[model samples]
Target: MRYLLYALTLLLSSSLLFFVQPMVAKMVTPVLGGSPAVWNTCMVFFQALLLGGYVYAHASTRWLGTRRQSLVHLAVMIVGVLFLPIGFEPPTDATSLENPALWLLGALFLGVGWPFFVISTSAPLLQKWFSTTDHPDAADPYHLYAASNVGSFFGLVAYPFLIEPRIGVQAQTTLWMICYVVLIAAVAGCALALWRSAEPEAAASEASPPAAVLPLSWGRRGRWVLWAFIPSSMMLAVTSFVTTDIAPVPMLWIPPLAIYLLSFVLVFARVEWFRSLPVFTLFPLTLLGLGAMLFVQLGSPLEWVAGIHFLGLLIISLVFHGLMAADRPATRHLTEFFCWMSVGGALGGVFNALLAPLIFDRLLDYPALLVIAALAFPPALYSRRAVQITLLIGAALAGYLVGRDVMIYLGLERSRELATLAAVALSLGIPTVIAFTRARVLTPALLSVPLLISTFYLGQPEGNELHAERSFFAANQVVKTPDGGYHKLYNGTTLHGVQAQDDEFRLVPLSYYYLTGPLGQLFEVLSKRPERHPFAVVGLGTGAIAAYTHRGQEADFFEIDQAIARIARDPRYFTYLEDCPGECEVILGDGRLQLAQMPDERYELIVLDAYSSTAIPVHLLTLEAVEMYLKKLTPDGILAFHISNRHLDLQPPLTRIAGELGLVVRGRDHWVDANDPVYNLYVDGSDWVMMAKNEEAFGAIIDHPSWHEYKPEPRLRVWTDDYANIFDAYILDF
Candidate 1:
C-alpha cells in the first residue's frame, strides 16, 4: 500500500507538470501575438525552474531527516496551491514590443511558476522518500521515475487531443486545480507512511548506507551533464527546424518532446529496450538519410521528410539517455545525480532557445548539435593510420566541392547540378565509410566537415541569384527567377511574396496577389469607388499589395519583423514598394496591438496577411479580434483574410465568427491555368475570405460564379479569447 501510494503521488504530479505547459502557453498567445518563438521562450523558463527544483530536492534530502524532508516538501506544496486557478493577466504595459520574450516570461512566472516548481521537485524527492521506506520496491526505485514520465507523456498528448478539443481553457484550469488537490492528498499519504516506518535501526540503515562502491568523481559528473545535454538540445533544435523549415503546424512540437520523455521511460524501465549496439548502428544510417534528403532536394513528400527527422531524433535521444541511465549512481546519491542532470538540461535549453537566436545568423545550432550527437556515440573504429588517411581524403573531397561551387558562382562552369550531386554523394558516403571501417575518435569531426560544406551547397542559389537573412522571426531569403525577370521572397521554405523585375510589368502583383487572384478581385471592386480609400495591411511581404494603390491612395503596413520591412523596401530585392504611386508607411510592432490604438474607422480596408509559414496566429482569428477589426474599419469597409494554408481549413471558424458578429462573409478560390499567359509571371492559386457590415456591397462579387457565400459548419465551435480548438480546424486529407 505504501509503495502504491508513492507511485500514484509521483505520477499525478508529473502529469500536472506537463499539462500546465501547453495550457498556460495557449492562454497567453494573444499577449505575445502568436509567434512560434513564444513557445521556445516558455521552454527556457520551465527548464530553469526545473533546475531550481532539483537543487532544492538535493539539498533537503542531503541535510534533513526522512520525516523532516517529507514535512518540508508538504509545506511547500501547500504554499504552491495558493496561486492556483492558473491563468495569465496581460501586463498593463505589455503593449510595448521592445522585448516580447521577457514580457512573456514575466506573465508566465506570475501565473503558474510556484505550482510548476513544486511539482518539479516531486519525482526526485518522492523517489528519495521511497528509498528510505521498507517497501519491496525500495531497493530499485528507478521504475517510479519511468512511471512518472509515462504520466508526462500522456499528459502532453491529452492536451491537444482529449482535453483541448473538449474543454475551454477555463474549464481546463479548473480540472487541473482539482488534480492538484488530489496530488496533495497523495503526498500527505506518503508522508504518513514515512512517519509510521520510523524505527531506530531501519532509520540508521536508511540514513547511512554501506560504504560507496565507487566514490563520485568530477569526470563522472561531467559525463552525466554531457549525456543529458545532447538530447535536451536536440529536442528544441528539431522542433525549430520542422516548424520553421518544414511545416508550421503548431502541434508539431509535441512529437519530438513526447519522444524525448519516452526515451527516459524506456531506458529506466528496461535498459534492454535500447541496446547500445543496435542504436549505434542505426544512428549513422538515419543521419546519412537525413543529410541526403536535405542536400539533394529530392522533393520527397512532407510526411516522409517529417518521418525521417523525427525517427532520427528519437534514435539519437535513446542512445544518449540510455548511456546516462547505465552510469547512474547508487540510490544514496540519486538526488545529486538528478540535480546535475537538470543543470545540463537547463544549459541545453539556454543554448538552443536563448543564445542561438542572439548570436548566430542562421540555425547553426541544429547542425552543430548533429555533430555533437555523433561525438556522443562511441566511435566505430580507432586505427591511428586509418583516421589520418580518412581525414586527408575527406578534406580533399570537401575542398574540391567548394572550389567547384566557387567556379559555378563565377559562371566559369555550367555543371552546378553535377557538382551538387557529387557533394551530396561525398556527404553521405564519407560518413558511412568512416562509421563502418575506421571509426576513429575524429570521425565526427571528419563527418561534420562534409556536412557543413553540404549546407553551403544546398543553400546556394537555385535561381538566378539568392540573398538570405536571419532574424528573430525567421530565416528570410530573396531569390531572383532563373529568367532574371522576377524576384521572390521566402520565409523558411514557404514563399511569402513575389515581384516581377521587368520594367514593363514591374508594377504588377505576382504570386497570391495576382490581378486575377481573390485578393486582386477584392482590390478591383474597392478601387471602383471614386474616393481615395486608406488601406492597412497587417503583413508587408515584398509590399505586393502596394502595387494596387492608386495616385490618391495611401497604405499603412504593420509588419512585426524589421528584417522583412527592410527587404521589401530595398529596390534591389523588390521594386513593389519603391514603384508604388501612392504614399506608403511601415509600422513596426504586433499588428493587433498597433491596430487597436488607431482611430476608429481609420481605414477603408484591412487585410490580415500575417500568417507566417502556414502557422495561423490563432489569436488574430478569434471573436475578440473580429470585433476589434470591425471597430477599426469604416461602415462599409471590408476585412480580407488570406486563408491559403495547406494544413488547416480556416473557413469554418471565419464563417462562425462572421455569423456571430452579424457580418456577411464571402469567399473565392482562384486557380490559374498553366496555359494562361500570366501563369508564372503574376498568378497563383489562392483562397480568401472577405467580411463586411453591408451585404449589398458584396452582392456584385457574390453574384460572380467564382465567389460564394461562406456557410458555417454546425459542429464547429466559435473561437473566442477564452476558448479555441485548432484540432477541429485541421484538414486531415491535406
Candidate 2:
C-alpha cells in the first residue's frame, strides 16, 4: 500500500508537469501570433525549471536527514499548491514580433512557472524519499522513474485527444488543480512513511548500502550529460523541423515528444530492449536514411516524410538513453545522477531552441545533433583494421557522389535521377554494411559525412540567384526558377508566393492571388464601391494582394515576421508593395491583436492570409477573432479568408461560426484552366471564404456564377478564444 502511494504520487505529479506545458502554451498562442517559436521558447523555460527542480532534490537529499527531507519537500509542495489552477496573464504591453521568443518565455514564467517548478522536482525528490522508506520495493526506486515517464506519455497524448477536444482551457485548469490536490495528499502520505520508519542514522545506514562501486568520476558524469543531451536536442530539432516545414498543426507536436518520453520509459524499465542486435544494427541505418531524406526535396505526401523522420528520432533516442540508463549510478547517488542529466537537458534545449535560431541561418541543429549522436555511441564493436577500411570506403564514396552532383549541375550527360538514386543507395548501403559488420568505430565517420553533405549541398534549394533569410519565426528563401522565368518565396518546404519575372506580367498578381482566382474576384467587387476605402491584409506573402489596390486607396499589411515583410517589399525579390499605386503601410505584429487595438471600423475589406505551411493559426480563425475583424471593418465590409489548406478543411468551422454570429457567408473554389495561356503564370486552384453583415453587402459578386452560398454544419463546434478543437477540423483522408 505504501509503495503504491509513492508510485501514484510520482505518476500524478509528472502527469501534471507535462499536461500543463501544452495547455498553458495553447492559452498563450494567440498573444504571440501562433509562431512555432512559442512552443520552442516554452521548451527552454520548462527545461530550465526542470534543472532547478533536480538541483533542489539533490541538495535536499544530500544535506538533510530523511525526516527533514520529507518536511522540506512537503513545505515546497504547499507553496506550489498556491499557484494552482494554471493560467496565463497576457502582458499589458503589446508583444513585439521582433523578439517573440523572449516575450513568450517571460509570459510562461510569470503565469505557470512556480507550480511547474514544484511539480518537476516531484519525480526525483519522491524517488529519493522512497529510497529511505521501510517498504519492500524501496531498495530499487528507479522503476518509479519509469512510472513517472509513463504518466508523462499519457499526459501528452491526452491533451490533444481528450482534454482540448472536450473542454475549454478554464475547465482543464480546474481539473489540473483537482489532480494537484490529490498529489499533495499522496506526497504527505510518503512523508509520514518516512517519519514512521526507524531513527534517522539507522534508516540512513540501511537505505544507502556501502558502495559496491567506486564514486563516479568527472569523465563518467560527462558521459551521462552527453548521453542525455543528444536525445534531448534531437527531440526539439525534429519537432521544430516537422512543424515548420511540413505542418504547424499543434497535434503534430505530440508525436515527437511522446516518442522522446517513451524512449526514457523503455530504456529505464528494460535495458534489454535496446541491447538487442536489431536495435544496434538499425540505429546507423536510420541515421543514413534520414540524411538521404533531408538531401532531396520530397514535396507532398507529407505522411511518408514525417513517418521516416519520426522513426529515425525514436531509434536514435532509444540507443542513447539506453546507454545512459545502463550507466546509471547506485541508488545512493541517484539524485546527483539525475541532477547532471537535467543540466544536459537544459543545455540541449538552449542550443536547439534558443541559440540555433539566432546563430544559424537554418535548422542546422537537427543534423548537427545527428552527427554528435553518432559520435556518442560506444566504439568497442570495431577492430582497428575494420575502422580504417570503412573510413577509406566512405571517403571515396562521398567524393564520387559530390563529383557526380557537380557534373549534373554543370550540364553533364549523366541523368540527374540516376545519379541521385546512386548517391542515396550508396549512402544507405555503406551504413548498412558497416552496421552488419559491427564496425562501430567506422559508424560515426561513415554516417556523418553523408549527413553533412546532404544538409550543406543537397538539402539547399536548387536554383540560381537564390537568397535565404532566417528569423525567429521561420527560414525564408527567395529563388529564381531554373529557366529564369519566375521568382518564388518559400517558408521551409511550402511556397509562400511567386512572381513572373518577364516585363509583360511582372506586376500581375500571380499564384493563389491571381486576377481570375477568388481573391481577385473579391477585389473586383470591392472596386465597385463608390468610396476608395482602406484595405487590410493579415499576411504579407510577397505582398501579392497589393496588386489589387487602386490609385486612391490605402493598404495596410499586418505581418508577424519582419523578414517576410522585407522580402515582399524589396525589388530584388518582389515588387508588389513597391509597385502598388495606393499608399502602403506594414504593421508588424499579430493581425488579430493589432486589429483589436484599432479604435473604430475603417477598412473596406480585410483579408486573413496568415498561415504557416498548411497549419492554419487556430487563434486567428476563432469566433472572437471574427468579431474583432468585424469591429475593424466598414458596415458592409467583407472578411476574406484564404482557406486553401492541404491538410485541413476549415470551411465548416468558418461557416458554423459566422452563422452563429448572424453573418452572411459565401465561398468559391477557383480552379485553374490548363489550356489558359496564363495558367501557371498567374492563377492556381484556391479555396476562399467571404463573410459580411448582410447578403446585400455581396451585391457586386452575388450574381456571379462562381460565387456560392456557404452552408453551415449544424453539428460543427464553433471555435473561440476559450474553446477550439482542431482535430474536428482535420481532413482525415488527406
Candidate 3:
C-alpha cells in the first residue's frame, strides 16, 4: 500500500506535466505564426525548467535532508498551485511578433513555468525519498520511473483522442485542478505514512544493504547525457519531418512523443530479461533499414514509411537509454544522475529548436542526428576481416549511386535503366551490410564514415533554387523549372505558389490560383460588385490573389512570415504584389489576430489561404473566428477558403460551423486535365470552399455545376475556440 502511494504520486505529476504541453501549445499556436517550430520552441522552455527543478531536487536532498525537504516541497507545491489554470492570449501589438521565439519563451515562463518546475521535481525527489523506505525493491526504485512514464504515455495519447475532442480547455483546466488537489492530499498522506512507520533515516540502514559504490567521474556522467541527448534530438527531428513530409496525418506529433515515453518505460523496468537487449548487435539493422528509406522508393504506403522511422526512433531510444540505465550510480547519487539527464534533454531541445535552423539552410538535422546516434551506441558484436570487407563493398555500392548524381552534375547523359540499377543496388546492399556489421570486431566510428558520406549523397539541397530562405516559422524555396519556363514556391513540402516566366503569362496567376480554377471563376462572378469596399487576403503566399484587385480597389495582405513576404514581393520569383493594378499593403503579423483588430463590416471579399496539407492556423476555422469574419464582412460579402488538404477532410467541420452560424457554404474540388493548354503554364488541381451570409451573396456561382452546397452532419459539432479536434478530420491519403 505504501509503495502504491509513492508510485501514484509520481504518476499523477507526470500526467499533469505532459497533458499541459499539447494543450498550451494549442493555445499559443495562433500567436506564434502557427509554424511547426512553435512546438519545438515550447519544448526547449519546458526542458530548461525541468532541468532547474532537477537541480533543486539534488541540492535540497543533500543540504536540507529528507524531513526538512518534505516540508519545503509541500510549501512549494502550495505556491505552484496558486498559478493554476494556465492560459494566455496573443499579444496585441506587432512588436512581440518581431522576435516570436523569445516572446513565446517569455510568455510560457510567466504562464506555466512554476507548476511545471514543481511537477518535474516529483519524479527524482519522490524516487529518492522512496529509496530510504522499508519497501522490498526500495534499493532499485528505478521501476518507479517506468510507472511515471506509463502515466506520461497516457497523457500524450489521451489529449488528441479523448480530451480535446470533447472537453474545452477551460473544462480541462478545471478537471486538472481537481486532480492536482487530490495529488496534494496524496503527497501529504505519503509524508505522514513515512513518518508513522519510522523516521526517514531510521530504516535507511536496513532498507539499503551495504554494497561497493564506485566514484563518479565527469566522463561517466557525460555518457549518460549523450544517451539522453540523442533520443531527445531525434524525437523532435522525427516529429518535424514526418508531420511535414511523410504521413502528414492529424495529431502526427503524438506518436513520436508516445514512442519516446514508451522507450523509457521499456528500458527502466525491473524485469532484466525484457528490459535489456544486445543493442549493439541489432542497432546496425535499424540504421541500415532507415538509410534505405532515403535511397529506395518501392511505392510503400505513407503509414509504412512513418512506421519504419518511428520504429527506428524506438530502437535508438532503447539502445541508448538501456545503456544509460545499466550505468546507474548508487542510490546516494541518483538525483545527480537525473539532473545531468535533464541537462542533455534541454540541450537537445536547444539544438533542434534554436541552433539547427540557423546552422543549416535545409532540413538536414534529422540525417545528421542519425549519424550521431549511430556513433553514440557502443559496438559490442564480434567479427574479423570478413565484416570489414563486406562494409567496404557496401561503401562502393553507395559510391556508385553517388557517381550517378556526379554524372548529371558534370553534364553526362544518364540512362533510365542505370538509375533503376543504382536504386536496386542500394536497396540490396544496405541489408547485406547490416548482416555483417553487427559483429563485435567492428567499431561504430568506422560505421559512421559511410553514413557521413551518404548524408552528403542523399541529403544535399535541391538544385535550380533561385532563392532559398528560412525563418522561425518555416523553410521556403523558389525554384525554376528544368525547362526554365516557370518559377515555383514551396513551403517545406507543400507548394505555396507559382508564376510563369514568359512575357505572355507573367501577370497571370498559376498553380492553385490559375486562371481556370474555382478562384478564377469566383473572381469573375464578383467582378460586377460596387467598387466601394476593400479586399482582404489572410495569407500572402506569393501574393497571387493580388491579381484580382482592380485599378480603383485596395487589398490588405496579412502575412506572418517576413521571409515569405519578401519572396512574394520579389519580382524575380513572383510579381503579383508588384504588378497589381491597385494598392497592395502587406501587414506583417498573424492573420487571425490582425483581422480581429480591424473595424467591423470593413471588407467586400475576404480570402483565407492559411491552411496547408498538415500544419494550419487551427484557430482561423473555428466558430468564433467565423463569427468574427461575419462581423468584418458586409451583409452581401463573401468568404473564400483554399481548402486544398491532402490528408485532413476539413469540409465537415466547416459545414457544421455554417449550420450553427446560419451561413451558406459551397465548395469545388477542381480537377484540371494535363491535356489542356493551361497545364503547360503550371496550372494544377485545387479544392476551394466559399461561404456567405445567404445564397444570394454567392450570386450566379451558387447555381453553377462547378459549385455544390455543403451538407451538415448533425453528429459533427461546430468547432469553437475551446474545442476543435484535427484527429476526427484526418483522412487516409495513402
Q: lDDT scores for all predictions?
A: 0.77, 0.78, 0.78
Better of 1 and 2 by TM-score: 2
For each candidate, give its TM-score against the true structure: 0.89, 0.91, 0.92
Which pairs of residues collide in candidate 2?
none
> Mind sharing the TM-score for model 2?
0.91
In terms of lDDT, the poorest run of 10 residues in model 2 is 203-212
Off by over 4 Å in 1: 91-95, 199-214, 297-300, 380-443, 446-450, 458-467, 482-484, 502-504, 612-614, 732-734
Candidate 2 segments exceeding 4 Å error: 92-95, 199-214, 275-278, 381-440, 502-504, 612-614, 673-677, 732-734
Clashes of each: 1, 0, 6
Per-residue lDDT over 1-734 for candidate 2, one digit per residue giving the tens place of the 0 to 100 score: 87788788778888888998889889888877656677777888999999999999899888995679888877887887777777776655444446777877877887888888888998888888877766666766777898899999989888988888889988999999888888888888888877886533444424432231656899989988998898888989988888777666667777888899998888777446674445666666667667656655453477887887889999988887877776777777888989999988889889887888877777677777877876777776324444445444554555566577777666633345444555666545664565476545565776576676656653345466468877877788898987888999987666788988887888888888988678877787777778868989998898988888889788989887888988888898898888888888888787887878766678988999975353467899999889889998999889998887767778889999999899998899877778987674646778888999987778767778888888888987888888999877765433
- Model 3 over residues 1-734: C-alpha lDDT tens digits? 98899888888888888898898888888686456689889989989998999999999988987667888888898887888878786787877788788989999999888888888898889887777666667676878999999889988888888889889888988888777778788878777665655534544533332221545889888988998899999999888877766645537777888898988888788755433555444576566556555544222477788888888899888877777777777777879989999999899999998998888765667778878987777655323343354455555656666566667755532343344445455546654666655555345665565555545544444546798776787778888887888788888778888887787777788889876689888888778776557889988988888888888788999988888899998888898899888799999888888998999998988999977543777789999999999899988888998878777777888888988988899999987788988677678888888999989888889899989998888888778888887765656564
Using TM-score as the measure, what is the rank order of every candidate, best first?
3, 2, 1
Q: How close is candidate 3 to the true structure, as a TM-score?
A: 0.92
Prediction 1 TM-score vs. true: 0.89
Better of 1 and 2 by lDDT: 2
